[model samples]
Structure formats: structure tokens, C-alpha cells
Target: MSKLPGNAGVTVLGDKSVEFYRDPVSFYGQRMDRHRGRVFLSRILNRPTVFVCSVRGARELLCEKSNIFQKDPTDLMTNMYGDTIVTTNGEEASLLRLSFSSLFTGNSLESTKGYVTRICEQHLKDLSSRGQCSYSVYKSLGTQLVLGLFLNVNPDEQPELYQEISCLCTQHWHGLISAPVNVKVPMWSSGFSTALEAREKLMAIIKDKLQNDKHGLVGTLGSLPLPDSSSASQHLLLFISALIPKALASLLTSFTLALSGNQQVETRRKAQTDADYLGFVLLEVQRLWPPFIGGRRIASQDCTIAGFHVPKDYGAVYISHAVHRDPEVFEDPDSFRPERWGERNAGQQHLLCSFGNGPRSCIGVKLTDAFLKEACMYLLQHYDWCVDPSTQALQYKWLPVSRPANSPTISFSRLDENPPGHSGS
Candidate 1:
């Protein structure tokens, strides 16, 4: 067995050192190609770690033996989420998952569709008037869209607060990347404070809407068959925290990509045929730029995987980025191909690892798809947009989420000259 440097519990094959603190996205494609079907173990300080890179290996670690392999609770997620479903395991996790499943059911999705469409349309209108904007469009658009879903607040109504909230979420996400070390940072402290303030602001909105019982998203959530007061409040907080960051990240990434694509020529008809093009794009992005690189599991007892010896209490980390981009599984794996996810192959789209597979798969997948679809449809129909080619080579930072190190600047012009519900207006 290979030994890691400095007595770190991690062991890498040959000279391939494990990089726990480094942003995995920086070498995402390369790592997948080099280490597919191999196991590389390293220690982040004193924590024992393992990185499984192949699709089959990851499946065994994440799905088949998931009970033994569990999610490690980073200080950041634990601080923000407490023992919420995203960080928990076993029966408690399942129960919490079940309690909130209704919020994302088919009927719930249908109900939110119109609201999503309206929000998307409203944001597009705002962007159209600007002609061009450079502040992280994904963060801006996603904040409003997610806030609408959570509290029914329009993007226009809370632009400043939304911006702050987006920043706070982004900061918190970065905290997760740095993990135990970041928890001690002064910046992390300030970010948490900001997040708490934002939460208060959000709760205030919810409280006000709860009092009014108005026809808003909060009103809708208020009407759900919630558990007891404590559980219900916990549910609300967890749901908001869990979703806000991801929704914002996905929306921003999608918006950035959409705006960068060929938008000068009218392509409304093409966009409609792919009603969920944004969702597809986001899915592809998740595959390409997964925020979380590894899934952890503790060995229940001595076991061997792929001829590697394991002792009881050993922890395994399934490197999802490596699995998602494995060349053997995906053709031209580095290229973005949304068409591969069309209806015909939707059933065959199991190779992606944005969401883990089997019982632990992300529960929010359906809702995410809904939000992505709506955002994509509205943007494609209403704007002619493109990325600045000079900025095309922008680097991405992998923290709380994968985002351009610099905000992707995009220009947009209204397709208002073309009528709504018509292609190429």
C-alpha cells in the first residue's frame, strides 16, 4: 500500500498526491481521466480519506454499500444546517426526507410552474431594459427565483436584500470547500453573521406573509401538512438553506451559459423544442462542475474493495467529479451536449453524478429541473444575448459552488421585437 506524505493517513498510488484542500474543479477532467478505476487515499490534516474515481467504484461506495459509506458533516454545513437531512444519515434522515417530500410532489411542481414562468419573465424584462449587465447574473436571477419559491417575494421588490443574500450564500458555500480550516477564519465568521441577518430578513418576510395568508408561496407552504411546531420550523429553515444556494448556483451557471450562446440570431423555435434546455444545461454543468467532490462512508467492518484491504472504522470518499467525467462512460466527456439529455435518452441518463444515485439521490432533483426549465425558457424566448468572447477563458472557483472566478459578463438585447409565444420574433 502507498503511504501519504508527512504521515497523513491518505495514501496515493505512485506520486499522485491527494489534494483535500485544493479546488477539484481546477483539474476535474484530468483527474477523471488519470485516476478512473483507481483509489487514491489522503488525509486532510488528521482525517483519513479515500477517493474512488470510477463510475462502478463510486456506485459501490455511494449506492450498494451506502449504509456503510455516509456523508461527512463538514463544519460549514453543520453550522448552517444543524442535523438537517442533507447532513444526516439513517432512519432520521429518511423520516425527515419523507416529511418534506410532499413539498416537491408532482402536484406541487405543477402549481409552481406558473409562478416560475412569471418570475422568469419579470427578470428577463429587467435585464432587457439594462441592455447589458455584469453582476453575476446567475446569482441575481437565481436569488429572486428561489426567494419567490420560498417566500413569494418578487425579484424587483427585494433586489438589494436579494443581492446580499446571494453573497452570503456564496460565501457560506466557499466555507464548505475550506472545511475545518475555513470554520476558523474571520471571514467565515463575518459570512455567517451575514447569513444569519439574511435569514432574519427572510423569516420576517415569511412571518408577515403567514399573518396575511395571501396567495403567495409562503401561504402555500403554510398550508402544507406540517409536523409539530419545532419540526415544521426546522423543516422550513432546512428547506430554505438547502435549496437557496443550489438554486442560485444552478440558475447563475445556466444564465451565464445561455447568455454566452448564440443569441444574436433569433432561436426561439429551437429554444421551445427544448423547453427544459436550461435544466439540461444545469445538469451538464453539475456533471462538469460538481461542488462536492467526495462522498464519505465509514467502514462498518473489515472489507476489501477491488483487492484493497480495508479495516473497520476506515472512511471512504467517493470522488464524484472523477466519476461524472469518466471517458469510458461519456462520449466527448469534456464537451457540453445538452441534446444528449433529450426525452428519448432521459431514461438512459444514469451516468451523470450531479446527484448521487440510489436511495441517497438528491430529493430536490425534480424541483431543480422545474426551476431550470422555467428560467431557460423565459431567457431564450425574450432576449438576444451572448458572452464577451474575451472573457470566454474565465477561470472558475470551486467553493460553495462552481462559479467563474470573475463574474461572467454578458450583454442582452430584447427580442421584444418578436412577439411572445412566437419563435424568432
Candidate 2:
């Protein structure tokens, strides 16, 4: 097998985690160009890592050779979220997936549709009343939807409890990004320590819900065939965490910006009326701007990804942003062309890694898809929107959730309702 193109520099001194975290798009883009290849070697998190930026390599790493390139058990996710499906490996992971899959798919998912519709309408119907809206507003809406669906914590009905849990979730999420050290003193405490405290409080709340609330996902999850008593609570914490909401808000914001303004009025109109076209629009938005930069895996055995050798114990990361734009799979990669999904890239949704691919793909994908369509359709039906300043910087910051760095605001005008079901077309 051929050696990877780039260097896996020596240990901590050579670690490029800081640089990668700062601007991962540019970091990987520069190396991909320099190596003249999509798959290259680099040091990240103080490990000899192989960076996979091509669709072929990603497919091989995450799908075909997945057994050899496995999830890292010692991943930061484990410390923050506990021994949940996200960080487990082997049979344990498989079992957890089997049990939880039932909650997020099929009838369990269909039941959430009514709640999704009501939440979308409640949050989106008044966009024009405010004239302009920012990312935070959508994020709040996302948070409410997640908490309400997963924990039965409705913001409208139990505003106090919702706000408290929301604040705790934010604190808990901060630990995922902050230093791993956990320390506390009389006057000073690390973010990690505070996060741990928040986790305990959230866990208490979750445990109570699981015991008392005999309805919704929480109730059903409490009865699942899990390995241990704590499994249900741990997984509930993962679901109610701030991460999903941020991701939901990220895509919603990108969708708004992508089709905004008079120039794309026809496109917006088409998306509203044509469900397939709306799907294409959402797909394009994700392809160009994925919420998460990528996911990481470790080589369990010697393996080849897109013809590059990855030795056992080596780290492998797939950059969704880079993989989606691979010219071999996506023509005119950077441009937003919804038609491409219907034409050249037809039946190629499998190639995209926005929610990842293969067996380990995000479990909530179906639920996420349903919620996004409902939210987007609400916006399309209620108002016509455009970037408030039009010239505002729309550059994205990837880490912790991908949204514009400046949090661009958009102006919305209520569509005239002369005829029933008017679309302002």
C-alpha cells in the first residue's frame, strides 16, 4: 500500500489541533492543494492522523472499511456525554443503536409531526412582525422543539423549567469545547467543572422525567432493552443537549440566506410549491455549508482508504465541507445549484457526509429532515425575506456549530393574503 501524501509530524510539539480548530476549511483546503490529493496525512489531537477529504476516501473509511476504522472510545464525547451510543464501539454500540433506532424512526417519528408543525408555526409565523430576525431566535425555536420532543419540556407550558434546562444545557455544552480539566475552588471554577455540575442537575431532571412522565420519547425510552439502568438517562441527556438545536439553527439560517432576495424569488416560489424542489434546496444548502466540519475515527487494523494506507491506531478524519465539494462527484462545487441534485448528481445523496454516511450516520436524521421541511415550508408560506443589509459579511465559522460569524439578520415582509393559500409569487 502507498504511504499517505502528507506528513504525520512528531507528537505534541507538532500537533496542529489549534490551527485546524481555528479555520478547518482553510487548513484542509491548503493541504489538499499542496498534496494534489484529497487524502493526506497530518497531526491532530497529538496523533498521527490521515485526513480524508474525497468522497471515495470517506466512503471507504466510513463504510466499506468501517469495521477496521472504528470509533474512538476515549473520544471527548464520552467524558462529556457519558457512555452513550456516540462513543461506544463494537457490540455495545450496535446494541445501543438497535434499541434507540426505534425511538427516532417509523411510528415513533410520525407521532412527533403534530408537535413539529405547531412549534414551527408558533416560532415562524411572526417573522414579519419583527421585521428582522437573527440566528439566536431560530436557535431558541430549535431548543424548544428539541426539549419538548425529547424531554416533554414544553417552553410555552413550563416556561420557567424550560429556561432553566436551556441554561444548564448551554453550560453543559460549553464543557465539550472547553479544556478537559475539571477543577473548582472557592472563588474560581473551570468551565468543565461548571458543566459537570450542570450535567448532574440535568441528569436529576431527566431521571425524574423518566420515572414520572409515562408519555412521549422519554417514557418509551425508559422501557427500552438497554444494557444498564443508566443507559436511558445517558441517552436522554445526549438528545436534550444544546448540540442538536445549534445544528438545526445552522441549516435553517443557511437555507434562508441561500434563497433570499428578489433575484431568487422564482427559486423560492418553486421550492414552496414543489416538495421535490424544496428537498433539492435543502440538500444544496447542506452540501455547501454542513453544520459540523467532520467526524473522527481510529484505525483498528491496517487498512486502505482510497488507496492510502492507514496503519493501526492512526486517526482518520473526514471533512464534510471538502468531501461535498469534490469536483469528481459535484460539478461546479462551490456554487449553489439545486438543479444539480436532479441532473448530474441524481441518486447521489449517499455521497454527502453532512450527517455522515453508512451505518454510523446520525440516528436522528429522519426526525431532523421532517422538522426542517416543516420549518422551511412555514417560512416560505408566511413571508418573503431578504438579507437586511445585503452587503453584510456572510463568512461562516464552523466549530461548535456552523453559522455566519456576524449572525446576519434578514428582513421579512408578510405575503399579501388576497387569495387563499397565497404564496406572494
- lDDT (Cα) of model 1: 0.58
Candidate 2 regions exceeding 4 Å error are 417-425
Candidate number of the best TM-score: 2
> Across residues 266-346, which tens digit of lDDT does each residue of candidate 2 receive?
898899899999999999999999999999999998888898888999999999999999999999999999999899999
In candidate 2 the C-alpha lDDT for residue 260 amounts to 89
Count of steric clashes across candidates, in order: 10, 0
Leading candidate by lDDT: 2
RMSD of each: 5.4, 1.9
Model 1: per-residue lDDT, tens digit, 181-256? 3123554455455455555554554465566755644566566554344444444455555345554564456445
Stretches off by above 4 angstroms in model 1 are 1-19, 26-37, 133-135, 154-228, 242-247, 251-255, 258-269, 275-282, 291-294, 304-307, 339-346, 389-392, 416-425
RMSD (CA, Å), candidate 1 to true, equals: 5.4
Window of ten residues with lowest summed lDDT in model 1: 1-10
